[model samples]
Target: MTTITTSAPAIGPLSTSTIAPANPRAPSRKSGIAAASLIRLSGLFAVAAGLVYAGIQPIHPADVLASVTTQSWAVIISLKLAMCLAFLVGIAGIYARQAGRAGWLGLAGFVVFGLSWFLQSGFVFTELFILPPLASIAPQFVDGFLGIVNGHPTELTTGPMAAAYSVVGLLYLVGGILMGVSTVRAGVLPRAPSVLLALAALVTPAAAMLPHALQRFAAVPVGVAFVWLGIALLLELGRSRA
Candidate 1:
């Protein structure tokens, strides 16, 4: 009688049917923080790049064709590679910080300046792949390429090279202006660096007009601005963490 009166025990759902809750917000927050860190790193790289760029001197074009082992060529190539990396990363970082307020101008500037760096990489390609063989076999061809500096005609610079130069120049000139304006509007970064950026861009064309030997040195203002911006970004990061 006692057994018959015992009630049946209740049963729960199978463990397989029970699902764990998804934590969507945590992943997103983590990613955002990681991205911000990269942006901060980009700022540092920019500072380094600006310094490298400022110290760069144009390799003697004549010597490139004649000498197989010139230290200047190596240095020039190394500096250029550094600049390319810094510009690409730093600009991307800038865009990230200013994304909210950068608007059309910022986008345009980023695109144009970004392309300039891409094309500038082509110069490295020429130096590494094309120039050595050309120098060994046809030294005159190298001379012709350098001739464009004096406003002289040369087949070396006829089509692609000429176009590359024109486009890169235009991009740097226009892009810098746009980015500077947009940065000022964003108010995410300090005004001084942004103003300096604009000034550097404005003076860049004049620098090109200078003697080839001195043109690279014209990057001083640009370098200084980048250094300032990088330090500012690091300080800002520290403040935010606090």
Candidate 2:
């Protein structure tokens, strides 16, 4: 009998084919979770910004020119800061979440909505830096400017200023409506809040047409929607972490 030294054939290193392939989606999933977390964080700013904006009622142009008190300035400045920051961080996350899912609508929403925010910041900048000083020196001029701000362009409003106001309003109104619709279609967020987002956007400009007392509160729907979306994102984030 052969020394029957049938030594066991040595096991070769496992072939690459036999090895389990790493999950391709794991990285993407992780990234999505991270993005969601970031979106949640930004939602805080959005919620605060919406609330502040909703609460604000631009002082009568006359009042602004007459006194420009410290408290009033502080409030206006705070609202501007919050509004700018909210859109900055909020839109980044909105784009991240919706871009992949909402297609062209998402793109449109992101562009117009983001532009609205940018335009708003520019307007705020003018208010903060230019108007205040001007108010002291040329109350009459500011009064004319305020007319534009109030969506009532007067003869005093230069063509450029009137154009700016129109652009801002159009962007905000149209962008908001498109974004809201896209958000609803994205289906990643809660449906109710998403609908509210759209409703708020649609109603906000219309709300402006309401009586003076109702005008300031026109922003409340949007604010509430932001708060809802923020809370939803945060909740989803917690689940993802778990």
Best by lDDT: 1
lDDT of 1 by residue, 1-242 (tens): 45565355545673434657789999998998888788888888777776676556434333334543366676667667767878888888787878888888878878887787777777665665576677767777765655554335378667877666678778887787777778888889999988888878888878877766677666677777777777777778767756
Error at 102, model 2, angstroms = 1.4
Cα lDDT for residue 94, candidate 2: 65
Candidate 1 minimal-lDDT segment of 10 residues: 60-69
lDDT, candidate 2, 83-191, per-residue tens = 7768667766766766779889988988898888887887677776777778767777877776676555567776998898778878878887887888889888778
Q: Please identify model 2 stretches exceeding 4 Å from their true place.
A: 1-34, 57-64, 67-69
Q: Least lDDT summed over 10 consecutive residues: which range in candidate 2?
A: 60-69
Count of steric clashes across candidates, in order:
0, 0
User: At residue 189, what lDDT does model 2 achieve?
Assistant: 76
Q: For every candidate structure, what is the RMSD over all alpha carbons to the true structure, in angstroms? A: 4.6, 5.2
